[model samples]
Target: MYAAAGANARACSRRGRSLILPLRPLAWPAVTIRLGHSHEADDVFLFHALTAGKVDTGDLQIEPVVLDFQGLNDKASRGELEATTLSVHAYAYARKHYRLLRSGWTFGEGRGPMIVAREAMTAETLAAASIAVGGVTSSAYLAMTLWNPRARTRVLPFDKVLPAVETGLVDAGLMVHEEEMALELTGLVCVHDLGEWWSGKTDGLPLPLGSVVVRRDVDEDVQRQLHKAVSESVHYALANRQEVVTAVRGTVGGLEADLADDFLGRYITDLSLDIGDRGQSAAEEFLRRGCETGIIPDSLPLEFAPSAAAEPSSSARDGARS
Candidate 1:
């Protein structure tokens, strides 16, 4: 389903403003768009409406694919899914096949990924110790790289990281999502909060973690509709919080009710709807930092589908051509 015109559009309009369109709309039959998301609770909550037929998808039929963030990132890299949630770090590699949608983002303010150890560890010791990371391409790993470029890492499933550290397999682990809450029961101590480190480094900018990306080959109108649908879905989930939480139905696994509420509040609150100016700046800074550290090859320009109220920001427009 890749399109030459779409690739050209991506190259020509990296700023997220003008989209290169076909001379005329191509005639195509009804299609089912494969949408990918993580199994995490916030992801489940945000996407519940679309999966449950609570939102109008226009003419597109969405078939949901739920997996770990790393799994989704892998699929996105190969362009196997039409749409999916991906770590912003992974997006650096997958930007060729997909463009970020404006809605359905996960950003952290004062709180973010944590480096946890079974026993207290100092910054110097943690930097030299082996650590379990959920994914090599995850934002958590990216943050760790920036925080401690000398740290040694091993990739494990996000759920397995804590256990690996508990058993002394790794000296520490970088964790996010529900894993953040599980640290206490595992008797792990937080050595460093990457979000806090990032916040201080960037003057309190939110940590841009994950975002929804759509395949470039998809029609522009379909992409816009998808963004609108996701925005509405988040709004709906917030409005019917109880219903959405109930719908998740133990998806978070052993998380206490209070902790589940806290998790949702932290990840999906206001930033889930649209990744406004602050989020965009955070993303740009991440790219800049990642590039400076050689964690990623280069800081690619971000191209998000335009929202109703604005065009892409001036920074986006200025750097897109590069």
Candidate 2:
């Protein structure tokens, strides 16, 4: 899962210029991305555009090294990859280690996270058993803590959660990301959705989704370029989604094309790349509550970095599906 394509896509220079980037096949910077899962709109556009070579990585020569979003998050928090989509909870956790890239996005009010389990295991009957989750420090674990403070959740990678449960290694899973979609297919019924569970507890507001963050060490100019490139990619993906629905189908595997389209329509939203003001507020509120309940550390250093649209007319953004 760790593919560090070191120094291969290095920046190039041209005669009599500061550095004329060699962005072959692209007018913009050449980035080598280690893509995340298709469910995320953050990388959706970038993946689409990069594949189409519609936009360059940056003004100079940069390459994207996208990994699985979860894989990206793991590597990102450890300062491995440059940029990738992630959960807001992961963003909160990552801020302790990296600088946020920009206001990528969040799911609207109606779309929320769910904690599915085998039909037999109900929350009320949960015992002191292990709950498999993706990544020990992942948002799934965070949600599990929020859902049941007393639940014993064992953090594992996303791929391991379902298998762990199938083998009875854990009693439940606080799944997020692709697992949310794949959970039902596993034949291990869902017990709950922390997001749905959250809405019931917090009125109608949707559960906090995730965001995109980059390493603090990244060049500021490159960060800006990445922000622009990804934003446009998201915009384009949303506008021309009907086309890619088929291409993305094979990535998720075993899903009906129509169902994939429906999933994209439900999970992906207009604010796919910019969480803007409302997302920030919701994130802050989530952090406050999570901290208040002792679910997350009180001084976890979680913050909401302002976006380009922020400051001009600061107001809550409309809640849309992620």
Candidate 3:
């Protein structure tokens, strides 16, 4: 769980504001929560405010660490980080150690991971083909398996998937992140958007791709404050779009300004601010499907921290009692 790193943090970038000094020193020391997020453009844009010290964290300080999405999921499983971004599939196993934050989640309406191939292949033919997948633990991989259990898979890094497909290393490739926007440059054709497929199955519910999780072991008050701080960061970014894009570009080199803006526009939405009733239902559906297909073992119940005014789950009530 997150604990105070020290009395003060190494000051953040000069571009943003610093923490406000307290009128008088408090008896308690300030806590610095270790935060882990992905290197994708959306995450970089969403987190710019928090990492740049633009949001007031109350008594808490957020120490940011950037890692690949798949690696963050793996680390979350081990409880290695106090707070981190994790794939929903990984969250299923770590439900005992973490509580899904109400905000900072990625859900898609009619867009998500794409299956790209050099040659046009219909969905019916894709069922029998071997494809390159980013990672076994990725939400994309889970979706691919659920979508086509019969297709064989070859694991490759996310960036390598498109190149592998272009070079004929695999029949087709599953691409996530910015690859969806760059597909045309590779001369590849998108066979299917998993998000659209999922929406069709669930009557237009957004696909719950990933979420932010805070260790359950932390004090409830501290966790709530940290959660609020995170939501504030996302709000700040939304209000300051150009700043977000510029700051994000400086951090994620080679990320075109336009692509970064496109990513922010796509991922950071109503769902990113708070997972409402609709998003909650979507999350449950994703987990239910995972369990039904045996991708995730049926063990812990899905118990996320609901929006402040939303109803709580019976499991959450039971957890509070114990």
Compare the candidates by TM-score and give the number of the best one: 3
Q: How do the residues 190-220 of candidate 1 rate in per-residue lDDT, one tens digit apiece?
A: 8899999999999999888889999987766
Sort by lDDT, best first: 1, 3, 2
**Displacement of the residue 213 alpha carbon in candidate 2, Å:** 1.3
Residue pairs clashing, model 1: none
TM-score of each: 0.84, 0.72, 0.85
Best by lDDT: 1
lDDT of 3 by residue, 37-138 (tens): 987777887788888889987767788888888789888888988899888778877787888898888877778888889888876788877899888877
Q: What lDDT score goes with residue 319 in model 1? A: 44
Model 1: how far is 285 from its true place, Å?
0.3
Residues 52-103 of candidate 2 have per-residue lDDT tens digits of: 5665544334355545656666665676655666666666556655665444
Higher-TM-score candidate among 1 and 2? Answer: 1
TM-score of decoy 1:
0.84
- Poorest lDDT segment (10 consecutive residues) of candidate 1: 313-322
